[model samples]
Target: MASSPTIRYGALAQTFHWLTAVLVVTAFILGPEGSEDEVFRGADLGRQAHETLGLAVFVLTAARLLWRLADRRPDPPDVARWMDIASKAVQGALYLLLCAVPLSAVIGTWLEGHPVTLLAGIEVAPMIAASHSLGERVSELHGLLGDTLIWIAGLHAAAALFHHYFLKDTVLVTMLPRWLKK
Candidate 1:
């Protein structure tokens, strides 16, 4: 399929982009937050849903990365040299975290000897024997990573808006929905 030659992303690339964004944001929102005391809130179902969402995000992101490698999408906008470098760096970090966050949670959950069930109730067995202390530590790291993803995502969106409104560039336009395009 031919992609837009100028600033528009191809349909497949745009689909992957938006799907990943929505899943990542949803996983962040559904995942546990704040103190350990308030983490699960004694809600087993909520925790299960959170775990399932994280796993789904990991799977989707893996496919997205593969798609990205194969797709001929629009190139980066003509921004300043420094901005280009910074943008690439941020994008790289976001992709890294997209994989890392969910994998960490899975490992942590497995190590804790907790059952990881999918949305359909398929059980994922533990990789290690029950070790509450270690699992707790890993869980802390998982929470930290999730929080960092949220912060970075905020910065990313803000930067896109800045580019579109202030710099008057194609950076944001390329990724916007067709109905929202100016």
Candidate 2:
């Protein structure tokens, strides 16, 4: 297939971006809101869904990063140098959080002497030695990171909207799927 154009992302990249967004949001919503004990109490459907979606996000992100290595991205829009730097920083942070969030969850669950539960009766046993106290701490960090991810993602979306409306540029449109582009 042809590489992405300087003007816009290819369909595959767009798909990866939008799908990851959807999965993250869905997983966040489904996450159980409670203490580590309550969250790991049982195999509830909501928790299972959240775990499954989180895993999907993690896997999707890994695939996206691999694809990024081989794919050509659209050129950055004309903007202030500071804006470019800020954008790059935000992008890097997002990628880091994408990996960290799920990893924290897995490590925390395992350390707490619990298996990472997913849908369809799939469970991943803990690979590390148990340390309940450390697990609790990591679980708390996971919650904080999850919240941070949402806030950062919101900021990212706001920036895209600003580019589309105020800057009147192709920055937002470039990542949009063909059907969504004008």
Candidate 3:
């Protein structure tokens, strides 16, 4: 069978893949703890950082989406039928949640009249009124999306491990860093 041309996923894809991966993990893990709850009320700075990173992930995901559209990526191996289907489904859901989580935050922030901070370490200017119901709802949705994201990411990671150990294919390597392949 003819094989596809292989190279590191275009630079943009690699950047989006790794950077977004780290940011997603960061935002999902640290976001909840930084919520406006009693426990972290004293650590408002941390909370702010969490919010900033959360917003950053959202924006980066958007950029990644745009980049994805510009570059068409190849599918997984034809031999791994089940893995291909499963990964695609999980990845689709992940993409959905990726957008949903940030959307919820945008809605919540707008409701709360909070400025969307992009981590310039500056003050956030609120666009809507503070203490609004919409903000609360969006915040709740954000939490739910975060939970979903965690599951999808875990499954994705596990699948990569499985691919390496069991499938013995280069599926995972397709996205690996350049140095690792050498």
Candidate 4:
């Protein structure tokens, strides 16, 4: 639990936040090469790695969402009312994207009749019938969502920086690791 009403997040919440951020960023970086069929027609190492990490993102994000719902979040910073609303909206959008991007990829892969190899090499067979056209369309959407996620995540970072540098608030510091705290 937070030590004070507006103090730092619980350790578990902080862990989920940082872990999801890392996995999402990694999955985004590996997306292009991994989604390329030419790079690995029959599960190229890069594609396999991407799929594996994507699955992790999907699972982790779900757990994070659940944790968030069940836990008490720290109160919003003592910013203006509008800033608080904006913060909530942006945070909600980011969470939506965090869940959507990887799930879309999973569906696209399954629709293409490709099995996904999980982190431990556990194979997941495709559930739906193969459809090249539909698969391509979904894949395109997956890519588009990934791009959108990156942009929104950038905006989220910028907002934190704005709070940290301009407002000089704890909004950013609350999420920082202990060593980074002033």
Q: Which candidate is the best by TM-score?
A: 2
Predictions ranked by TM-score, top down? Answer: 2, 4, 1, 3
Runs of candidate 2 with Cα error greater than 4 angstroms are 1-5
TM-score of each: 0.87, 0.95, 0.80, 0.88
How many residue pairs collide in each prediction? Answer: 0, 0, 2, 0
lDDT of each: 0.80, 0.92, 0.72, 0.79
The alpha-carbon deviation from the true structure for residue 53 of candidate 2, after best TM-score superposition, in angstroms, is 0.8
lDDT accuracy of residue 140 in candidate 3:
77
Q: Name the TM-score of candidate 4.
A: 0.88
Write the residue-wise lDDT of candidate 4 on 15-122 in tens digits: 888887888788777765544466337545656677888888788888888887888866667788988898889899888888888888878877777777654556
Pairs that collide in candidate 1 are none
At residue 148, candidate 4 shows an lDDT of 91
- RMSD to native for every prediction? 2.9, 2.3, 3.3, 2.7
Colliding residue pairs in candidate 4: none
Cα lDDT tens digits, model 3, 89-181, are: 998998888888877876776676655554444556766667766677777777888888888888888887777778787667768877785
lDDT of 4: 0.79
Instruction: Give the runs in model 3 whose Cα sits over 4 Å from its true position.
Output: 1-4, 32-43, 112-121, 128-131
Ranking by lDDT: 2, 1, 4, 3
